[model samples]
Target: MDRVIIAGGGWSGCAAAVQAKKEGADVTLLERTDMLLGTGLVGGIMRNNGRFTAAEEMIAMGGGELFQVIEENLKHKHISFPGHEHGDLYDIGKISGAVFRFLKEMGIHIYTKSRVLHAQMKDRRMINVTDAEGNCYSGDGFVDATGTAGPMNNCSKYGNGCAMCILRCPSFGGRVSLTSLAGVQEKMGRRPGGAVGSMSGSCKLYKESLSLEIQERLGRDGVAVVPVPPELVEDHLEKKSCQQYALPEFRENLVLLDTGHGKLMTPYFPLEKLQKIPGFENARYEDPYAGGKGNSMRYFAMAPRDNTLNVEGVDNLYCAGEKSGLLVGHTEAIVTGVLAGHNCVRRIQGKQQIILPDTLAIGDIISYVKQEMDTPEGMERKYTFSGSFYFQRMKEKGLYTTDTALIQKRVEEAGFSRYFSHSGKKDCVS
Candidate 1:
């Protein structure tokens, strides 16, 4: 019953809360916005490319509740899109509520609209975190899943002006980094050209805004690929946070996915230009009201952490999601969050923390990203299991696989079968 306070209730924070609860810790998840799944509120893609293997690996390790929730709420499964295959698009409209309910059912206290603005530290350990309302949340250990999305200033300084993406920083106050608050020096991810932050790839479009032809194609096949006119195509691929989707096909065609709302595959398309395309005459953005301009900027503040996700130079704080590194995607966040949560609890109990072995893709990426981030070149790249350089590395290292049984065996061999499910409670919260 050790108290574990988690900041930023995105996918990673939710995953950490669940795993920490399973490890017999009293968990409290604080989110800046009113809803769960920060940037993930707009993102619906899962089980695509190497993510399929990564998801199965987490399931085998007994940390699959979130994935199960996603699977149950999936709108389309095993569908293929440009540069991605065997993908699952969860209902973005339904997923946030579903995940929130799942965490509550597991006995984790959730406080939305509660943004942690300051941290009280004693020596090297965090004593408590004070929310915007001055409410103090004290914990034995903490996890910072507060992702690297933005606080308006970063977006305006780095990319185009605020696109009003799902993070809704304008409404809930900008993302405040717990690691930075605790006196730890954080890092910023950069584009290849050394820009400060990367633009959020993919924007959501109102389904009804699209024409009948494109709508029908998306409904039937879960994806619609319309060729973009040569003159209308805008190339913003290199500035994309999700480099996995930066492809010639994405530039040449308007690839839309059925995620309740239409998931536009580019970061942001000009509204005027989008209207010129066939079947998109009435296209309008659903998430970023200003999708015609730009999307949310991400990777502005990332915490330096070890492979176990413990924030370096801090005794009682752990970090996950984008805070853990330049890692993107919901699956990456969930996996890192699970490990961080479990390890945080173990640290509280004075037990040795566990790190997944390189035999599995999850472990490999965590260790590999930490190693790569030490160099200047690695900071310029974004990592995700879906696609991009990491996906290519997965293929080269034989870590990318669609076979569930193979991933399960790898997890079992790593001695992590039901690792997050060990239960021994002492009511340390009082």
Candidate 2:
């Protein structure tokens, strides 16, 4: 029996474990936290990426047939709230819960509150891992779906900064990070349709350092800012232990603050100092995740891009979902998880490799990450807008996938085209 060990039980970790088990590998998942707090670890930021739409035309004409197929399998419905406009929000927690249920149904061993301390590597191959409780576990192949690339971090700390690359600049284009708050009023009053007020207030600011200034200006209009910062933005973060905080999850009719900036933007400075900023005062503490402080960063929270998934030094170990570090949203995470899962199984069986949809941006994303690590010389690294720069590299490789085209198409279809314009000179996916 092939034994496989997985670290972290968040979306990515759970997805990976399920996939590995399906492939006939005995999978063990280690989650540092005891219970699954679907509640917002930091102000329910996970609940609101808003609605990200891909172009239906592209999805149809392109090789992205799987995109449509998987999306159709997902459940979506219009939810109404008092004093707010009701729109379709994908029940992401449900999707994650489904995976967890599937894992349990399969009889996989799930270890909660067991923190994997370190991996014992022999000849650069991971042989065993030690947890916080002094329990030593070994496996045939280890799936490091640890959001912050936990195993890779241990390896890099002892070895050279191998298996990962941390971009220092806070202003990565594709990524953004911001805090949000709830407890606001509906301005438009109640309408017959559902609610007259908007469900969420969008944050216009882009920079991490200017987050407070931007929030102050926006919050004055009844908008709240959730305080979720990237670890790189905080100075004391690297030195001090992680500060855990309890956060409230949104249920029916829950008002949430804007987290557009804090969750997506990469932090320029150390993220620890940002918590000490003026706005985050009186923020209470909650449960901590397995990977600690760095993993909690908004950018990392979106999705991780550790070199584990990339075709590099290691051969047997395969990564997927948020742990892949390239995926940002739930749909992408699940899709990639499926792809990685299917492909890893096929590869083990010595069958043909599963080729990703080249037409879709997601496909290009995985390929681009592989290319980024290939040269290692003067990689034009910049966080333009979340992971947009990576997509831009894919463009250079002849892939014309952009969130703008897809998002704009949806906006136009929804009769809100004017709200988004290319002429504004401010690129959403810059």
Candidate 3:
């Protein structure tokens, strides 16, 4: 069996490992931190707006294992909040562990605290990677899921000093790109006004710190929208990576979702000001311990790659997630990871790598992001199936639908239903 190594065990890397294992490849996933699911440690929103369609499409294509696991861990489902609808909020506290166990069961070797700091390559093909602790891993083909988030310096230089978001760069020694190690010229995306990077769109507030009514409402309905006084409203929308949520509603209100915490739908709110709001007198941040200032910065080290996710200038290297472009959201990352994983195996087999046709949302997005990333304006923006430029485009193209049957049928017609599913030897089911 061909050994497929995946760097950065975020949602993308985990998904890549799953697809690779499903294709009967020996898989190894490396995560910089002690845990898996990078930003997903605090990010729990799923299937919001067009994300529902994209997710269903993924399920139809037989790449929905992680999505299924997430749904199983959801605290609330079929919810509506702000600009998002029919959303599901998972138990962020349990998701990483759940994903870890699933990947382990799938027979993918996962290494935490294994940050890839260097790569050995022959010509354009990568041979292996060395981690921060001097541990080396070899592979037949590699997937650069090392997301374009932070190494702390980017956060300090671009946004506010590390609000200490989930990436935990301070301890993990920051994200070192596998593509960069492989000597590929990577790209950097911009904020709205052509700034270097974008701030994380939201933060997490400890659920216990919120007022009883807000906590009760959130725990019950999975969301609580409290109107923010105009005087306290902050206008940092332009700095947000999640442009989809950069709306007047978000600015005018404190939108909190129950993601095993109060998911504050803003980049950062002044802690003093947040305390002044009703039902938030004890408000406090959870993930970015310094949410009053700013959150972690992202889109810093995007690798230049084709729609099929093959890293340009490298023969056996592929990329997904933020490393692939300015594509944001876990759904986008997982889908791209799935494609990259499947295709890398094909590359090792000396077969033509497959590309999802534009007929499907997954295919269109993979192709669309690469095309859009070529332009200046596109670089200054983010893309996701849930919202922003891409969702609108999905609507305009008549590709947005909540009907799961239609999505499944579409995948079948595209000749890719259960495309990633393969019966392979089982190592352990426990």
Candidate 4:
């Protein structure tokens, strides 16, 4: 009852492990590659738009361990970019080590290079999981945070092939879903015209390769927007997975954020064309190494789950991050991860698992994304707190706010102020 095994060590999986450990469980986290954080290695944007409200909500909810780390490591704070405001960017170069140290200090068992490829289930509950190395791991509960990116095959079929982003599919093998391995039928997201998956909306560039002016500007402002000449602008927004960044401003300019590496906000920009733009003359792709063509693909496989984050048809299986519906962004993933991990322990404890009341932003999104993901139209779009439809909805519902004290009060009003702070006798209060 005290053991939990979580597959995948991205931001969500890491958060899940943290919550499970805090719940007094012996947690074991398995990651596919040599390092952790997965796509988070290339992602550093935080607190932009409704994300500010969501982050504050989580902090007040007692799920702020990771958020604290992120804030401490942010290279730039309170910055703005095209279609986004009050954003912060973490130093990608230092984040992996910092997060790794935190997890280790918490005494969570972390096994890198442990890609879970198989699972053994008894009745409706998972008994154990086996990594690609043939090592078996058993626990009282399980979580599938293995994200929805590619394994080479899906990218080639659905995207412009693998842009070789941070997932490092070839080196460590692509992502393998624990939900699918448990004999559950998984769902795949589709594009507007019935395409299989969506292309990742961003790529990393070597900052040193940029012109002195651009580099200096990024250092000073954390964002550098250079207008793309009319002819140099290539329209790949249709293929972008991050609908949040698919604004006209993104295409009108080459928006770069300082996340250690220059984060280019586009599915992929052709190098030859990108070079034609004024300061990007010496620009180079850091990740994927072929940003000229495309980037990593996502939303290939999602697990069907309830608002409580339990995988349907499985008694002790839970999911988070991209595996949990079409929810995107680190904020979205981290919150879902906390819920799934907490619920896994609650289920094993034989307590009635709790669902966040939609009064709070985190809770609302948990239920909203699940409901939206059920329709044909909903499957075509990505949901995040940062921007686009979901963010708009947050504002309309009075769920979006940046006031820290107000967010704490809102969580208190939702009756989950410290729900994740420690094990609870009841759902709302510990």
Candidate 5:
């Protein structure tokens, strides 16, 4: 039997190991911590796999079929807003535990409280990993799913650093979502009354890039959601961290919030600052999580042109999930892990595994960040202290708006609008 090793048992690692086992390969999973919960997911980010059915399909085909999947996973119920609905507050621990349980049943070996200190390599391939205790583990193929730890730090050809934080509601109970609020008025025939804030319902916060500035400009353009200026930009810019997590708990009707900051990188509501804001004075942290800063990584986005999992110049090695240049959310992490694990097995078997297409949102996100976006030249041009560098780039490149109409405009600008249409309707609550 071929041997495959995976680091980190988070969503991507779990998925990869399960998939590899299903492919009939022997597997070992190493986790620095004892559990599979991700900090970024505390108060779980909106689970996006396209529409409801796509989400259902992910639950179904991702190792276990849908109903069984639901029974094993955490099922969340969204709340009814005045004109919209917010996704349910999923229990991150419960869901990850279920996934871990399935992986275990599939005959995968799991090592807890073990940290990969370094990867032993030869001729551009990783051969083994040395744990913190000085124990060495070797395998025929390896999966680097160590959140941002294994891949970004250990394998990237170019070293990297990034940071994320979580913002909470200023009041005791408040709601937040990454749901896109762009062009929401046209769909409902009337705009939602009052101010619109932080829709996408799920928004991805970058590392103090021009995207932040674009969000500010978009606010000036009368868009509802706006990016709050960083409370401590200099501090955040000086150092970097990455992490993932289970969702934070919330009070009745109050949605737990996060942003790309602090411990976990989830939706933020800005509780402390809410007290300073004129409209909010009663904000508070919903469920405060206590743990190491969080599971974070600054790693590559994808593999080489052939799409093999190997990281060049890094020997006896492979990277999976965030470490391998895969930038998807929870769903993509799991799915990519499956693929990475499968690839590891196949590499050992001297065969090829399947790959997803870039046309898919998840696929494209990974592809661009890993292979294209933020080129060295582009970085040199934009990484300046113009005070509005990030904002200007976001507008010019149209990067920050996920609004369907705005997305449509961008697609049209790229000459793909004729092939796609923006359906203003959001996913209906069942």
Candidate 6:
């Protein structure tokens, strides 16, 4: 069997491992922290706006196992909030463990606290990757899902001094990129005003800390939109990585979602100011611990890769999630991860790696983001299926739809029905 080593056990890495394993490859996933999910440990929004279409398309293509897992653990489904509709909020508290178990059951070897610190390369191909503890993993192909979040230094340099976000870099020794270790030149995403990086758009607030009325609303309806005082609203829209939530409504109101924690839909809010609100008198941040000041910084290191997700100039390296581009959201990561993983196995089998055709939203975004990243303006913009620029583009291209049958038909027409469901074992190319 071909051994595939994946660095960074975020949602993208997990999806890649599952896909590669389904293709009959022996897969190993590494994470810097003790837990999986990376940024997804705090993110729970799924199937919002065009994300719904993208999720259905992946399901039709037989690469929806991760989505299914998320759906199974949903805290709320078919819920609507400002600028987003038909959204599902997964239980952030439960999802990482669920996904961890799912990947383990799929037979993918998982190593928590195994941060890839160095790569051994022969010519342009990576021969092996060594973890922080000096343990090394050898593989036929590699996927760099090391997300662009933080190593604390980037956060301090580009963002407010370590808001202590979920990445927990201080404890885990920061995120190390396999692409950088393999000597690939990586790219940094820019904010709207040409800032080096963007702040993670949301923070988690402790549910019990909120007042009973606010807690009841969140518990019953999956959302609570509390009006913020005009004087208390802080404008940090331009600094947000999730541009989808950068709207006037978000600025005027405190939009909280029930994702196990009260998911605050803003980069950060002053604790003093938040306490002044009626239902938030006792509200407190859960994840960042310092959400009153800032959140984690992201898009500091993205790999340069082709539309097929193969890292340029590297023979056996692929990338996904934020590492692949400035993609946001869990659905985006899962789709790209599935492609990267499937392609890694194809590279090992000496078969032509597949490119998702433009007919599908997944294929279109993969190609679109790569094209946009080459330009200055595109680098400043974040892409996700949910809303903002990409969702508008999806609408313009007639790619966003809720019709499940139509989505399945489109996938079948693209010759991608069950594409990632391959179980055959192929002889290693070399």
Best-performing candidate as measured by lDDT:
6
Q: Candidate 1 — what's its lDDT?
A: 0.91
Cα lDDT, model 3, residue 171: 82
lDDT rank order: 6, 1, 4, 3, 5, 2
Q: State the lDDT at 68 in candidate 2.
A: 35
155: Cα error in model 5, Å: 20
Error of 2 at 397 (Å): 10
lDDT score of residue 257 within candidate 2: 32
lDDT for residue 87 in candidate 1, whole number 0-100: 97
Task: Report, for every candidate in turn, its global Cα lDDT versus the true structure.
Answer: 0.91, 0.37, 0.89, 0.90, 0.40, 0.92
lDDT of 5 by residue, 190-254 (tens): 00132111111122222122244433432232122222344511112111221111112111112
Q: In candidate 4, what are the lDDT values of residues 280-390, reduced to their tens digit?
A: 889899987878998888999999999889999999999999999888899888999999999999999988888888888888888988898889999998899999889
In Å, residue 413's CA in model 5 sits off its true spot by 28
Q: Is candidate 1 or candidate 2 better by TM-score?
A: 1
Question: What RMSD, rounded to one decimal, does every model reach?
Answer: 2.7, 16.7, 3.3, 1.3, 15.4, 2.0
Candidate 6 colliding pairs: none
lDDT of 1 by residue, 373-418 (tens): 9999999998999998999999999999998888878877777766
Candidate 5 Cα misplacement greater than 4 A, ranges: 40-43, 49-71, 78-88, 149-308, 313-316, 326-328, 359-363, 374-430
Where model 6 places Cα greater than 4 Å from the true spot, the runs are 423-430
Off by over 4 Å in 2: 36-99, 122-124, 149-311, 321-323, 347-353, 372-430
Model 6 deviation from the true structure expressed as Cα RMSD, one decimal place: 2.0
